[model samples]
Target: MNADNITSDTRSELPQNSSADAAGEKTLKKVANRLIPYMFSLYILSYLDRINVSFAGLQMYTDLKMTDEAFGFGLAIFFIGYFLFGAPGNLAMEKLGARKWISAIMVVWGAITMALALANSIHSFYVLRFFLGAAEAGFFPGMILYLTYWFPERQRGVAVAKFMAAIPAAGVLGGLISSKILEMGGIMGLPGWKWLFLITGFPSVLMGIVTLFFLTDKPESAKWLTDEEKAWLKGEVEKDRLKAAAAKDSVKLFSRETTGSLVLLSLLYFSLTLGMYGFQLWLPKIIKGFGGLSDGQTALVTVLPAIFQALGMIFIAKSAERTGERKLHVATSAFIAAAGFVLTSLIDNPWLSLVTLSITAFGIWGTVGPFWSLGTSILPARIKAAGIGFVNSTGNLGGFVGPYIVGAIKQSTGSFHYGLYTMAASLIFAGLLSFFSERLLKKGTRIET
Candidate 1:
């Protein structure tokens, strides 16, 4: 169907009662107002904990007497645990409930993160990082699945955009905080890098405790919502579920179409993540390479790209929602990011390199909302949790590959140019695949949303 037809069909499904529509809007606002803040906070902390190691690596590499490859392996190993546990962890969340499962994951990961401070050797660092990955494996996909319970298809893009904005928020805030924290060396005879992990990991524990009481698993269990509001929300969700069931011939865990979609989505995510982590983990070092900059100066410079990235993510997601188009938004973002990566590699000027890096950050980060919306929108409700888990787990393998490849190439070639070029190619491939995947999905499954 055409865009106009899709919009019209969507409109036809809306409630006829203006008063009810207003009431529903108010209820949704209330739900979002209550839920989004806590979720956003939790995600920021989660992201910070996961990536603070990059900042720590600025000094910890020399402190622990580690090589570039060893540090890269440490970064990559976290994803191994993440990849292994993703699907099962998500399924466990489905069985055990989000409140309990998410809180548990947070608490355990928080402890593991704190313990990272005590690591005095490369082996211990690897072990701690691996466990940290295992502890935090399902949190992202689990949160995605959790949002599906609260928001319908039409609203999910905005909801997810706001939530995922935490990525860049973590980057900006975490960078600033980590820079200062790194200045705390010899405060207690411990290095600033040790203090970085020690301080950042505690919030997750507190947030986990807050989540236990603050979050509700489903709309039905939320006491803040009235009976009328609950009924309206649940009714709307039920309509989506029934529609998904009716649209698919079978909602099995593994079907040909579903599996194909998952694999494509995985590759798409792999490419994007390669750029995301490669930039994130190495940006500080990249900035430092320009010379004549302190660690604090490098950290502050990293904040600009994240700020722009957050803006790009929110703007692109809102546009995707306004246009009711997912595939093109994702493809275009990837293409823009690919160009940015390519340019960053070729540019010789430091200022120009920073601008290009910002563009790369914008493109890779911008893809998050529309990409998830596209994946989740077409997934069968029956297997959404598991399917999302599978896609996330498989895709995150890129997290491992991205840093490792960059490190390996940097070591071998003695320059980051080759790594940036490789990531650009990956992004270009992803953009092309996303463009073609839209047509394939439309032809094969009659996907509308």
Candidate 2:
């Protein structure tokens, strides 16, 4: 509970840099270097696992002859289970700690994903989605819990942004992997979709196992941190906690403040995700509109945005870390994403459309790093896990709404344009919300909590 207990300083005495800025910078670089890779890997693979279904969606649609509603319901069902566990999962991450809880969640979800290879009908898909959602429920929240253990208040935006670099990164990885799997679909008495499910699920199993040994729950738990650094961090955080509480404004992670963050985040996330999720679900089909690429080419093209996204994430995360602020990074990223969506919706030229799409991917992925960091920063460690859990679980509703909404729009209008416009609007709303949120936060409202 004491901040002194959680410091990562390298000395028995705190650094005497004579300036807070210098010491904080050293800590930022040190922590970022140490944790970024592991965080990045975990995030990329975890996200890949979550959205692998989208990659498989095209094939599944063909094999199952899924109606628009049927597919949407199935996609949305994942979040139903995801939402149910929001509070519990984060609390579990906090009480049980990330190492054990996350490992268990990974194993369960991986195994569940592996089981998807057996799905035979819509009924089976629905069942699998429910279980998959339940299994995957805690992973995101577990990540938030994990981060609060390592990052300080000022550094949180960049710290979280780095971890979140995986969203679009997943897109790239998913596309490549999906393409390969699609290629392998007919080789071993299975369809490409089957291969996608099997290959994607296997990583969850492998990563879950790897993380047990590799990941630490907190800096305090790291044998690497110096005693003085640990003490100083503890003192620093506790100082803030006391100040917050004495001001009758305790920043507990699961309080009303956090709920406020969850609301704005979920709303913003919903709109952004609408564009993202719908885009992912129907992208191959949209590319098919170009009428030039083969199914394989379509899948491959789908992967390019992910690469742009990964690069964007890395750039913005490091930038935010250096700047020690999130507003500009987040707002800009959101706006960029919105622009990309708009371009894709309006541009009739294929190359230009794809380029715009990739740019949007860059923005979305770039902004996500800061989005989550901003979400977690206002809260304290105790409920940090749960707060983020609530955020992710709720935000996933956008995931549910996106694909279905897109499909419905497409079906009704007989063009992807309507659906695309719907998605763009979502992105714009999210951007505006982020702008307002930043302003509110600067005034100490924590409205974006």
* Candidate 2 C-alpha lDDT tens digits along 373-396: 565555445565445545555566
Local accuracy of candidate 1 as per-residue lDDT tens digits, 266-332:
7877887777777778888777777777776777788888887787777887787788888788889
lDDT of every predicted structure (CA atoms): 0.79, 0.69
lDDT score of residue 32 within candidate 2: 73
Q: Tell me the spans in candidate 1 whose CA falls farther than 4 Å from its real position.
A: 1-14, 152-154, 238-249, 253-260, 322-328, 373-389, 438-449
Q: What RMSD does each model have against the real structure?
A: 4.6, 6.1
Candidate 2 wrongly placed segments (more than 4 Å): 1-14, 17-35, 151-158, 217-266, 311-336, 369-393, 434-449
Best by lDDT: 1
Which prediction has the highest TM-score against the true structure? 1
Q: Which ten residues in a row have the lowest lDDT in candidate 1?
A: 1-10
